[model samples]
Target: MQRIALLFLILGLNCIAAGAAEHSTACGSMQLAYYELGTLYYRHADGSYTGIDKDVVEEVAKRSGCKFDTVLESRVRIWTQLKNNTLDMSVSGIPTPEREKFAEFIPYFSTRNYILLHRDMPVHGLSMAGFLNDANLKVAVIKSFKHGPKFDEWLEKLWAQKRVYEASDIDSLLRLFLARRVDAIIALPTVWQPLLKKEEINKQVHLFDWAPQDSIVHGLIVSKERVSKARRDLLRKAIYSMADDGTLEQIFTRHMGSKLAQELRYDGPRF
Candidate 1:
């Protein structure tokens, strides 16, 4: 009878341990990817991710009790991995309709686009019209960037004239501009600021006073298959909570600087 009691006690302890392990693992592990950019996201010397997207997502995960891992990769690879189920989610400033088929966006941040040009480049009064009309001009744009169908049509027209160069990444395009290989590049101010600062090209590049075709709305994109509705809702709620509590603003301010925050007019659902 004592031997039988010991067996039952051992079984009970095993069950308790199993239950505790399951509880600890309830949130599961997820992988999120972001571009290796200065303002958006980047890997630290310690192999950790940091930037606006990282800060916001980490805060949401902390509040929601969701365990997550981050992958710092190229934007192209991130999208490819996300499609293949290697990445659970990503934060992208521009999400195209083609990408929407595989992922759902949790709307959060938005900003207007801008053009970056060499400060001493003589062309003034920069505009879409001016760029298209100048045969001597060369413009560099990134691959997979969603500038809408209208812009694509305009680019096709420009391409016929050998005016626009499609670059693999922003860094390459920026280098082209710095080397005087291209006349200008179109990108959001947020993206330009960090890279310009990094290359000490701030004094060399000038932001033209041209109006953007559209304002970009940034969001957290999750794989539809990987995240359940309950977890998705929980994460969204946590983001909203962070916004309400000013945590989002604090994070943005820490990385982006207060002056940039004000310039961007970032008065929205912050987190």
Candidate 2:
């Protein structure tokens, strides 16, 4: 009785609000995968996962009385599996119309996507367009990432102009930029800055005047085909409860500080 009460309190709901599923039921048996966001869910030497997103997911599970067999996989595989109904949930996803067809979202936080300029460029006040138009300079992006509709259109023009360098993931993109192989990179500091080792490089990089997507969000995306509507609603309510109780704020602020949290506009379920 005491343990159930504690869970209910943490979840910000009475268990009676939504009849609890058994520990071995469909939603409880679902598989969860964490995308390879370095700080978000990197494997420790001991093979355990820990990060802001992981913490949020753990709390949601406790509140909703759900359990998952967690795995770490590539973002591409995670999405493919979710579409094919082979995977149950992913904690790191940016919602899009295409994704909406396959997954139901419970957005927990937002992120900023900005262009990083190599400080060696003698020009000040250079914008993303100016950098892209310069034939000698190359811009880096993760292949097939939708930085937002506008950015995607601009990237198409880049393809015709032969000014784009494609990387398979953020790690490779960062390497190409840091090695002086690319003049600029489009990325999120919230996700990339923590992976950087050299404080000097961070100082050396400057933000381009144009932000491609200033307010792209990150969230839990559960498979619409695999999880029932009831389960999805239960999870969504649990996530919103965390935000309402300021648990989401604490988790993000601990990793990103108050300023970035405010700047990125950490929010829940705008959809």
Candidate 3:
């Protein structure tokens, strides 16, 4: 009798453990890392956070039964966390050849580079090649953004003849542009648009033609260390399902304006 009761207790314990694992296996418990940039991500006046990336992630988590923990950090720090295995996932990251080695990607978002200039400045028909080749142009870009290094390398190859000032964040860069401290600032349209709207700087700056060379496909980046193949496959399926069912489009349109959301959808996959 005693042996039978002990066996039953052990079986019950095993069943409980198995049940817990299965219940918690949903993606809802995953922690997602993202940067605090204007439309991409930001803290609201009420202390709640909202952004296009956050909206999409939330919907994905809901559909996947994953709980998300969003960490607010700089773009570079977000990458560092993912590389170090501290973060499970991140969004709006532009994949470079160098980054592909460390992280697995799910392509979904589209991004473009815009040349932000003082509304009063007389500049038009700018090109990346022309900007880099010029000896007298001064450009301001956010430090640690994906384009920074590419721009730096290009400038160095030109013997660092042009000035490339690095601003700490988007707001500072926009302020510098408005103050006429730099000839131009470069950033994604999604990031630049919100800041311009918030600061009422739209009338103060003129957006030049898109920089196709610098534009990139943004995607969700998963840490290779923390997630198993099964989990990764699940994530990919969820993303594709969202894309097909128009969940992705709905989230994009809800957070970003309809016009911009339409553009993002048309930009094609960024791999």
Candidate 3's C-alpha runs over 4 A off are 1-28, 123-134, 148-159, 212-215, 266-271
**What's the true lDDT of residue 185 in model 2?**
82
- Model 2 gets an lDDT of 0.75
List the global CA lDDT of all models: 0.73, 0.75, 0.72
Candidate 1's residue-wise lDDT over 1-271, tens digit each?
A: 9999999999999999997776556667788776776677866789876788888887877777778787567778878877887678888545677787788777655666667776766654266677788788888889877654445566788889988888888778877888888888877656776766755777777786455545566678888878887777767778777766878767767777876654443345433
- Model 3: per-residue lDDT, tens digit, 104-192? 88877665676776655534326567665566667888876665345546546543554877888887886787777787887776877
* Model 1: residue 153 alpha-carbon error in angstroms: 6.5
Q: Which 10 consecutive positions of candidate 1 have the poorest summed lDDT?
A: 262-271
Which tens-of-lDDT digit does each residue in 197-233 have in candidate 2?
4686677787653654456777799998899998887
Q: In model 3, what is the error at residue 222, expressed in angstroms? A: 0.4
* Candidate 2 TM-score to native: 0.83
TM-score of each: 0.79, 0.83, 0.80
lDDT of 3: 0.72
